[model samples]
Target: MTDRVLSGCRIIIVEDDYYQAHDCKQMLQQAGAKVVAVTAIVPDLPDLLAEGRIDAALIDINLGHSHTFDFARELQARSIPFAFLTGYDAGMLPDDLATNVCISKPADLHRVVSVIAGLASRGG
Candidate 1:
């Protein structure tokens, strides 16, 4: 196991896949993050954010049938840093969100944890 580099971060995960979400949750937990919320739907995001402090987010670009650009906008507006985990290329993302981090699906677990940790450490 690695060091607890993400010890103080609180994260929200918005992936629609059951296995992927659970796997990601385990990875973050192992990295010492408190996964405040994990859901396959987008509607819960606003409520989750309103419920408590969230240091960062790992979002899947597609939530089964819906897209995530609008939700990402809200996260951006709230100053909560997030990165997309998608199978698609960067060109597939909305233009406004083009600059945000885009980690490919089947993500590198270490990279995912490290990116979120970096965002929290930077106070983003």
Candidate 2:
């Protein structure tokens, strides 16, 4: 294990799967991110964003029965930097979101740390 690089940054996780969410949280926390909240859907997302503390987000491409593209749209509108963390392959992502940073599930913790480091460095 390495020292946490994202020591003070706030992260929000949007994953519907309980085990996946737990894994993500553990990884981020290990990397020193302050995980403000984790949610399974977009309906409560706006409220969470309104709290004005999230530095970035790691979002699952699908949230149970719902796709997270709409949530991604909202994040874009707010100018929040986010990355897709999905079990699905990159080819499964929508055409419009193809350019966003994405990490395959069973993600490499170092890569995830680097991604968050870049986001934080960019003032996300």
Candidate 3:
């Protein structure tokens, strides 16, 4: 286990997998982050964003039958740092998202914490 490196960071999880989301929430909380919301649908994100105070986001590339590319763009526009938590490789992503941070599924929780902590610190 890692230290409470994400202390005071507020985050959102955009993943459809119930077990993955639950595990991630627990891990993030243990690392000292406040998980503001967890949603499987992109359309629901606006309301979550409207509530404000999100430091970063951990988003899955594929959600049910759809993908989160456009949602990722919106997050970029809002200047909220985010990382893709996907089973796909970076080369599989679109050109625009290829440069963004990406963490594969079955990820190392400690490493995920470190990445989120860094993103939160950057604040965009």
Which one is best on TM-score?
1
lDDT of 3 by residue, 36-122 (tens): 988888756678767877899999999978999999998888898999998988888889778889999987777788889899999
Write down the TM-score for model 3: 0.93
* Cα RMSD, model 1: 1.2
**Per-candidate RMSD, Å:** 1.2, 1.8, 1.4
How many collisions per candidate?
Answer: 0, 0, 0
Task: Kindly report which residue pairs in candidate 2 clash with one another.
Answer: none
Worst lDDT window (10 residues) for model 3?
43-52
Among all windows of 10 consecutive residues in model 1, the one with the lowest summed lDDT is 43-52
- What is the Cα-based lDDT of residue 71 in candidate 3? 90
Instruction: Give one digit per residue, the lDDT tens place, for model 2 in 21-102.
Output: 7877888898899998888876566688577667888899987798999888877777778899888888887787787899
lDDT of each: 0.87, 0.82, 0.88
Best by lDDT: 3
Q: Can you give the lDDT of residue 32 in candidate 3? A: 90
Off by over 4 Å in 1: none
